[model samples]
Target chain A: MAPVVERAREVRYATAAELPEAIVGADVLFAYDFFSSAIPDAWPAADALEWIHVASTGVDAILSPELRASDVVLTNSRGVFDEAIAEYVLGQVLSFAKDLPRSWELQQARRWVHRESERVAGTSALVIGTGQIGRAIARLLRAAGIRVSGSGRRARTDDPDFGTVTAQEDLHEALAGADWVVCIAPLTEATRGMLDGAAFRAMADHARLINVGRGESVVTDDLVTALREGAIAGAALDVLDTEPLPDDHPLWDLPDVRITPHNSGDFVGWRDALVRVFTDNFARWVDEEPLRDVVDTSLGYVPTDGSAR
Target chain B: MAPVVERAREVRYATAAELPEAIVGADVLFAYDFFSSAIPDAWPAADALEWIHVASTGVDAILSPELRASDVVLTNSRGVFDEAIAEYVLGQVLSFAKDLPRSWELQQARRWVHRESERVAGTSALVIGTGQIGRAIARLLRAAGIRVSGSGRRARTDDPDFGTVTAQEDLHEALAGADWVVCIAPLTEATRGMLDGAAFRAMADHARLINVGRGESVVTDDLVTALREGAIAGAALDVLDTEPLPDDHPLWDLPDVRITPHNSGDFVGWRDALVRVFTDNFARWVDEEPLRDVVDTSLGYVPTDGSAR
Candidate 1:
């Protein structure tokens, strides 16, 4: 409701390393802080700039004091990676259901093994943090005939997006009922280490946990223990507390755990998608139209804010 | 028009190996002699058998001269595995599209490699053999926003089941336009080697082939050649010319090939589904009603005679 708008006069590109230099003289500044070798020394003035867009969805690192204090509009590429990440989640689920890895091993040994697999239908999914990724995950799960729920900062009884909505304090109740627990919660102060030993213990033994969000939201040691003790059936992680987990990392040796580098939403055309979203926001800024997917910085994300857009 | 209706008589359980012993002593015997550990040597007499329901949709082995001489009702498990097979096909398509195998490799190395992936939403699929499996394939494809067509031995333009029902000779046209070619044809003498070098050449360079019906319906050597030469993009095979493709088989080494041990329609509770179908048929037989999915000795399978129920 604070209505922080941008009035563009001149543009600056403060990306870490070399970039396409296409927006040299435009009245907009585009930055790729995530891929840069070093941070830019100088910051753009807020009053002189009308729009500021980050290439990555998570703006925690790039949210400098000047960018925050300035009244210019701030938007991140939120919806660009939704479909790709959703597809990745579906692929991992199917790969597990179909026992593809075991089949690959059997093929290598020329052993004609016949293993039965479970279906995705009639399952229940609890998606923590009802953000873009969470919504996409819910849509795909629903399409697969699974009932889905959501857990957020506040409880909402009338929200039709989730069959069950539980407040953050009641996360355990939601975890206990979920057949598939998907962690897409932002790594905010309130949600950090949210899924720990207690939450894992509350999960159904047959449930599968998938994390495509921040790794800090889950306690890695507790997840490993849950998997080892069969507290939960299986898990697929695309993000870890530490990027490029060491080869000797104990997490790699877990039997029912799937570990991937944090590339779930990073597709080949992803850069272009980010640019497209930013360009659309840029066009909207010049027209004095309200921007989409603005970060709260205080609440970690803009609240459903009545519109649910 | 041939009503092969037999009298109340004995039933032999030749396919007892594939099915459970509980299915024996049935008024209508299901002779599933497919890859069984030899025939049930202590089987009941043929004279007492009122009907011989084959577990497999194809009855090539059971359609012998002696069995044909009898008036026993010969039904097949035609519709039992359609949905399961369709799910398997969808799994393969998604796996290929999302680059699951490559992701699996990168996960092992703890490397974050992002790549572009194709979506199946707007592709065209050509399903050969417009039977239960073919119809199921079309339905799933339609759900995924894909256009689908089917070709059969007999052409029927008025049939809504297939977008383009063409004769066997017109298969080239079907293959030429298809982005995916699914072969579920019966393994009659005519269908054997139907997908040979010429057929592969006719397919689009980006098309993929999936075979779930019968192994003998495709030419293994020609298929290997097509994949190796990039005549067609890739293939996911459930059934093959050999049950367990020998360690030395060349098809196993093909880069674009995915080989499974003929378990496309196999999943958890699949046995229950087969039993359920058989139980329904058994009830109909007890009521002296016409059976469904009766095998047309000439065409392999068709609906039961119009007047028999």
Candidate 2:
């Protein structure tokens, strides 16, 4: 940001509350606190704003109807979180399959009980998102020998990463055959509350859910019921509807549930990486060249047809 | 074993104490608690023994001077545990990279502290063995986007799975470059106590050691010293110098040590898979065809040239 600071006529850094005034005459805005919901309120003040670049892969947080209807172009840090989140998701899957949490507890007690672990090779995984992060996870999991399928907004027969793309509409039918269902969809009307009790009920008794997507995508209470009733085996949630997930939340102590702080994609040096993405895009903006990761705000995501990679 | 019962004149199961008498008239033996040391004691009674099949990858427990000198053929369940151990190793690597154990502790206390994690992709791994299981691990890690190299009995500039395999004697030099050191080598005179004090000292302070191979390959005291002095980052040991490690062993309370009872290769249905290998070999033996995974007695492993998959 320092290198590009001199290029702007005036540069302003502001908190969510100060965004309205800060965005008044700004031609470009960098949403550093990407999850901040002040964008809608500040939208009326973005008088000369032509572009808004976010330091996150998901644009749902700032994608308001007014901005989508306007001429302001939106871009995101799309490719940045792909590998990091993919690695995180794979770690969770392996942790569950290998019974690592139990081993940690047993190690604490100095217990040497040898348990038989499941092999990841032949097991199947159903990735709910077909976006870059989801594709990265599918590739990584496939490399680990897990058969990977996908459930996206639309069904496709020939996806390079996910061999069979099941339509999100038929998610329950797809869940029945999967050993693990990974939800990595963005937050949208259709995606929110997608993994409700009924979806969990459709999963196999041994299937586990791994959610690294938006917290709002899953119905928290319904998920709690699913885990309690044994409708599904367990879950590894990196995001929650309410976070730092209320210290006294039921999910905190669920038997087999794994709760990781929403830092899956925040790998070491990620801040620098995010800045690099913004600066690179800023350089393109100054040069009047094509920008990268432009979001299709109407869809509340960077559509696959766009230059997503 | 029951299916192959009719083909043999007699099928006998023997404990270490009763093995001497049990081997009196046996033509073939299936060494089932593969780590059993009773074979040498029962050797003299195995007058008619033509072959010995082990239910394990490592034949160290059954390999004896007499058995090597004798005409008896030695075969093992080699391919059975390759994928299983590879997945376990991958899991351990991910577990370490993602700081999952700490997350488990925090989750226990309902604490949400977001920490940056390392990326597994693009990081390098030094796989210390070019055998079947080691090869499997190399392939899986490579699939996860990790750069893989190997250390074997001999060095090679160009190899299939491991591009540049360092000689076992130059292991210290190789230790400096890898983010992860995966030990999956078979135990032999050269391998025993291989990872000693000097070797640990040569490794980068940030490097981690994962041992799925024989425990004797690593000197316990030296590894303890290495961890204590920060000679190396940490270790995840699936095998230990002592089985059912003493309740008060130093490793139990070591900050970064992960101790799992030697079950890295034992996945669900693994016992059945090992049996299938033996039964298939038995059927071949009855038909007078070449057996699979025949251990090269002089080399103490199924030589790479000996039809090893």
lDDT of 1 by residue, A109-201 (tens): 667777787666677889897877787777776766668889987787665667567899999988999888888887787888999999999
Please state the error at residue B132 of candidate 2 in Å: 0.4
Could you tell me how far off, in angstroms, the CA of residue A185 lies in candidate 2 after the best superposition? 0.7
Chain A accuracy of model 1 expressed as TM-score:
0.83
The reply for model 2, stretches above 4 Å from the true place, is: A306-308, B306-308
By summed lDDT, the worst window of 10 consecutive residues in model 2 chain B runs over B1-10
Model 2 chain A poorest ten-residue lDDT run = A1-10
Best by the TM-score measure: 2
List the global CA lDDT of all models: 0.71, 0.89
TM-score of chain A of each: 0.83, 0.96
Interface RMSD of 2: 0.7
lDDT of 1 by residue, B1-309 (tens): 001222333433334454445334444555444632232332333335567666666676566655555576687777667766777777777777777766666666656665677666578888888877777776776655568888787776665556667888899888999998989887788888999999999999889998987889899899988998999999888898887788888777566677878777777877766666676787688777888777776666664211212
lDDT of 2 by residue, B217-260 (tens): 99999999999999999999999878988998999989889998
TM-score against truth, every candidate = 0.84, 0.97
Global local distance difference test of model 1? 0.71
Q: Which prediction has the highest DockQ against the true structure?
A: 2
Among all windows of 10 consecutive residues in model 1 chain A, the one with the lowest summed lDDT is: A1-10
